[model samples]
Target: MTSSIVFDPLLPWPLLAVLAVIAALGVLLALWRGLPGWLLRALAAVVLVGALAQPSFQTEDRAPLSDIVLMLVDQSASQTLADRATDTEDAAQALAARIVARPNTELRRVDIGDGEDNTGTLAMAALNAALAEEPRARVAGIFMVSDGRVHDMLQAPDLPAPLHLLHTGRQGDWDRRLIVKSAPAFAILGEPVTLILRVEDDGAAPGDTLSEMRISIDGDTPQSFDVPIGEDIEIPVTLPHGGLNVIQFTLPEAAGELTDRNNTALVQINGVRDRLRVLLVSGEPHAGGRTWRNLLKSDSSVDLVHFTILRPPEKQDGVPVTELSLIAFPTRELFLEKIEDFDLIIFDRYKRRGILPAIYLDNVRNYVEQGGAVLIAAGPDFASADSIYRSPLSAILPAEPTARVIEEAFRPKVTDLGHRHPVTADLLGQETWGRWMRQIEVDPLEGEVVMTGVDDKPLLILDRVGEGRVAMMASDHAWLWSRGFEGGGPQLELLRRLAHWMMKEPELEEEALWAEPTGQTMRIIRRTLGDSVGQVTVTRPDGTEDQVQLEEVAPGRFEAVYEGPEIGLYRLAEGDQSAVVGLGPASPKEFEETIATGDALQPLIDSKRGGVVALQDGLPSIREVRDGRPAAGRGWLGITPRDAFETLDVTKTPLLPAWLVLLLASAMIVGAWLREGRS
Candidate 1:
């Protein structure tokens, strides 16, 4: 297919040039001297020099290679929202057929799925990878069939040829998105936290701008109200308890919209206590009193106010303030004034010694009824006539003390109920537990008897008042375990669980339902006191429901891993308890802007002389255009023909033979000699 002249010199070109110069000089000298046959001699010298310069006619056999055309099909989640999926499929088929029909062209079709981990549409990244795999010289064109909501636009590759985008979705398509502009991951419990949110419609949305919004916590019944569209609204939330709290906001889906996935947004905020204020009242100095104080003081988040009544009201001897080493307890400020501010109050070995009046004790009783926690660590005095149970505080006490104390050594035992209770479940290996030497006899009035001592008497009882919690431990010898008695049991851990449970920690709740999102799967957890748990109903963002069964991993803990097939908020319900958790991001990158537009891909397309044409109008025909020229027009998309080829074989033929040169030179010499003889 290609031909050219090639040379192979019999002698070096430098030596040939010298011989030609000498021959030309000889001819010039003879002509000047009027010598015969000077022209013949010069002709003979030229013929010999030309024969030394070997030249051949070269020809090559070549094969033409087809130009490669790449088609990027975007099948991400957004593309399936409405009729965009149909548009994309049909357009891709049409374009592939058209490209294949062209002369000497090959088609490479690549499908783009949802980006990993909800990264949205990776159209550009996928296209760049496809380009890297093919030969750049042979790549004639690229096309994208998508909704145009690409997230990785910065990864667009340099155009080997023009890029043409056949957009899906119609101009009248619209979507409503609920955006949580700002939400903190941590919030203080019992304090109002503000969340900034906005609900707006993209594309064309009809009806009033004011839309109804529903807000729910922990998947409870949502509260609805009208919120103005296109405005950031501040929603104040006061968390009911501590630990992970899930709040979900939703906008009711209308008749015609892309999806309701973006219509709902979920925000998880961990509720933590700003400060745990504890009131510790000790009746007298004892060996175990320091254990409670040390435990509470060790936590930096706890504010401990400890008071030891060293001198009772009966101490009216001549020991005045000068001799006494104690100051009066702030009973009025603690029990009456600031009792509600404290999260927990401990009555350790405390008895009615007249230090705190009946009025103060009554106030403490009222405090427990109004969402406060009370823990009574009993000592020998708890069974005496001066026991605090004799005061008005006995109204909320879970047990009533009998005037008897068991002083025999016996290891404390966890009751059947305690094995199912979060506070004492899985606390220790019961066989290795140490013994407590003393325990007060008490009759369970109203509460759960979680622990027992010798003769199966109540050692620990827990109960809930109106909106608060109360706990009673019948023995003061728990410090023996802390001191490593008989291979010390889980004393610290038990006490910690008790304190947190009394403070209403969500993880320490006896009954709870929540879901933790883990990479496209939700670890649905259900904590209950019941023997068996039921199936959990999962409600997807698309209003589809799935029943998932839970497996018991521990005595009271049950869980199941549910694979999340879609992105957005998922509601889980097991019996009376319901929970809401966002498996993937509630506002996914794909659905962030559901309405199709070419703004993101336009710049990349323009850089390569490409154009974005909506498929809703029509599937454009394919054509071939020159490189660097406009490749997109009103009714067609263009690809450039690279005109590239590969050579197979080569051949060469000499222009002149050695015998011909010799014959021509001999004739000229004979003619010159004849002419000279005639002269």
Candidate 2:
């Protein structure tokens, strides 16, 4: 229990001050008058004033809350290396047990994990969170168990009590990690691109020499060369193909190294084409030919080779064929000799008019089989008696022409499958887009129907033949959609997506696995036309598979997030789909090739005037040292003692009761005044 005297004045302090001055003046006037009645009046006035000031003795029961000790455990990717995790766990358990055994101390254990993507170990952030949950007065001290590679040092909160770090690793540990100082996402194929690579040796003495580093491309033979201790060197690498190229770089570990996980780094560079070669063969010349030519020629990257058969087998209007147009179409050069050189071939309103021989059609079929793309824009001629389906090229086509054409105006709508396919999906959702008016009707078989026309027949079909892809747009009147006959559409975007898809762009693949690393969290996305995908298997750098089920939020998009356990190249595979993504850096800031040394954390340790005691040397005993005293002694871990005291008893005695003082002073003055008056 505690007690104190509290005053409750009847008047405000300003008013009381005025009253005190007036009473003092009246007493002075009575004393100067030397009258007995005046003295009695003064005493009566003082008694009245004392009664107005209210005062009370307050007492209450109280209990003391226990002091809290924050225990911050680093469980980041670095802590998981080798026996460091075990060390941290054991230290935390021991500290918690000891704190619980104390008489008036409570333990708050906070586990600090890796940051969101791979930012690093956010030790200070965890400390701040733990501090926010507890009372500052109750905080006895803070104990941190970590490798001491904290990234958010600026965010560290003001400690109410002493802070201590129980370092986790041993001294004299060394590490070698591969660091890619600079790398580009997209590089032109066949051109040399410089990649900045740094082979660093951490925890080693300044004079220590680093061994050779190996650089390789796609698991090919590695080139070995020596690198300096702490400098970046430029290495030129050329991509072999116009696709994704995976490059791996590694450094050999020295003796007494902590880990080899950070010794290797993988980079994925997308290769871009120097030129997009396109072959456009027209069976008949019309206004649409100008449209096709303008579209292909508009792109600076596109190299279009357009050929039109103005003189058909039935037309004999030429005075002399050589004089009309002397330049002959190099059918063999395009179809047979350099078929693979062209990325895509478009057949617009073409029929079996014997312009391209059967041998050239055979070559085109072989081109489609060998990863070449082909697009057939059919008109009424596709359904006529002279349809190209009767030619040798029909064998490789996805659908057979019915030889019946419906030339009616109808709105083209996307199919259910098309709503999820990359090429047509979300094309109509844009506010600036318009609708297509006329579409040709055609029955599709053994292919994906992307668009439907009159009578719900397929207007557009896409199919994969062998390694190549083929798309058939049943109508040449698609240009009418662009001309806004009824309403305009996103004609240019549709064509661009179609062309890129045919070229097998990675982002346009029907089934793909893409992962983006922010911090420690990997935002994994799986795209497929299938209803639901199986569990996604993620293989870490250590070759451990973590399988997680995906949740389908949309028709074709499936997503899930995995908190990366470590910082390295993580391979994610969903069914047959696989992608390699880097988590954090080539080496984590904490581990960075894990041979433990006192280098990176030396500044922090020295700032606190702390010493590094190796666990391998001996387990040190804890001691309560005085504040400002040396916190380390021989074979002992010194803990500074705080001068803390508990309230035993509290009491407040008023100088004197206002009533008692008033009565005593009045009686003395009245007796003195009466005696003086009698004298």
Candidate 3:
């Protein structure tokens, strides 16, 4: 309980002040004139002034609130390194017991986990959130039990009290981290991609010397070499394929390092073709020939080299060949000299034309075997004696000509195998496709028949020979789809998929395993032509293995979601297919700097007059300290007691009564007058 005198003036403060001034002036005048009993007159004036300015004795009823101590415990990924987890939990429990035991003190404990999206430990965010839940006046101290590697120091809130850190880990603890200083999201195929990387040793590093760096591309055998620590190393790599490439770098863990998590880094660099060079060999000027030309010309990245045999050797035109307006075919230059330069070769209604000799056709066969792509769009000539099957390419052709061409209109239908093949799988709006006027009949020898026409005859065949791919379309009416005959189908998408699949794009692989990350959970996807895919064996970054059973979501498509406990590379494998995907950022903020220290946060700690005590020494005791003073010592952490209170009720009593004031003023005036008259 507290009591004090408060005044309620009858008039404004300025008016009351003027009245008091006048009364004091009268007393002074009486004294200056040598009036008898001047002190009694001054007393009466003072009593009247006091009565006009009403004063009351005010008292309050208050109950003291307990001082609040906020303790934030770090449960981020970095805390799981070494013995920091044990140290943090033990210190938090100890601090909680001590704060609860203290008289007139409350403990506000908050356990913070890894920040969303591998943002690392947001200690300041956690601390501020915890503070906001408690009364600011009652908050007396703040404590952080962590490894002191806070990522959000700039987010520190206005400190209502001192902040202390119970640092985890040891003084001699060290860590070796692989830093990808620079990496490109996409690199041109066949060009050397330069990567700026650095390997660093932090804290009490073991012997400042070189460390071995291992590099692996697309799950290949790792190649290693000794690289100097704390120095940038530029690694130039030429990608093997034109698709997404997974490149990983690792530094072998040292004996006393903090963690191996930072020792490895995964980077996914997409290998893009600088220019898609396509060789189009047309047999004659045909209506469907421009469809292939138009499709290839649509993409600016594709360089189309169209060679048409407009003038065959058997032409008997009297006009001189040199005076012809059409551009002469450079058969030798394209078929012999620069044939290997093209990524794909398209034969649109092409036959066994005399323009390309048997040797050039043989070279095309060899080209397909040596990682090249070929797409044959057959016309009516394919069912004749002059078919490409009669050339040296017959050895690699997936089907043989039956010398029969069906002229009846028929709608193209995907085979059962085509529904699983990446090239034709899930073709959007395939049911709305129009009919083609003709399809050449053929007998399948090898490869998979993905599409059929009337009488279930093979219309499309896709196969692999050596390291290359071949696609044979038995019909030349695909242009009908592009022209929107009846209702157009997904011609563009189908063409794109077919071209990319022939180019051996990883995404179009019929049998493959891959994953994509959504936050910390990995969506594992398996694509195959088989009925079922076995459980995928996932090898975590920590070298732990887990068998994940996938549920089939669509035909030949299996998927399963795995919530990763750590943010790093997870290698998934199903049978002969395997892939590596990073569940989070390659270098997560959690493991960037795993050493336990407060150097980065010294300014924040100093502003709060806090101290950093290592758990390696011992868990310190709690002590009370005055505000605006240092609150930490070698053996203890100090918390100031706020001594806050709330007023339940307030009572006010008048200090002076009106009757008493009137009586006192009259007596003083009478005495002063009597004294003056007697004198």
TM-score winner among the candidates? Answer: 3
* Model 2 stretches with alpha carbons more than 4 Å out: 1-69, 80-116, 205-210, 214-226, 240-246, 272-342, 345-374, 380-406, 409-472, 483-494, 507-586, 593-658, 661-679
Q: Number of clashes in every candidate structure?
A: 0, 10, 0
Alpha-carbon deviation at 136 in model 3, angstroms? 0.8
- Estimate, for each residue in 403-473, the C-alpha lDDT of model 3 and write its tens digit: 99899999899899999898888886667798999999999988999999989999999999888989899
Q: Clashing residue pairs in candidate 3, if any? A: none
User: Model 3, stretches more than 4 Å misplaced?
Assistant: 6-56, 93-98, 518-520, 540-545, 563-570, 582-584, 616-623, 633-636, 654-679
TM values, all candidates? 0.80, 0.68, 0.86
By descending TM-score, how would the candidates be arranged?
Answer: 3, 1, 2
Q: Over all chains combined, what TM-score does candidate 1 have?
A: 0.80
TM-score head-to-head 1 vs 3, winner: 3
**Candidate 2 structure quality by residue, lDDT tens digits, 257-327:** 77777778778788897789999999998767777888889889999999998777787775787577546
lDDT of 3 at 6: 96
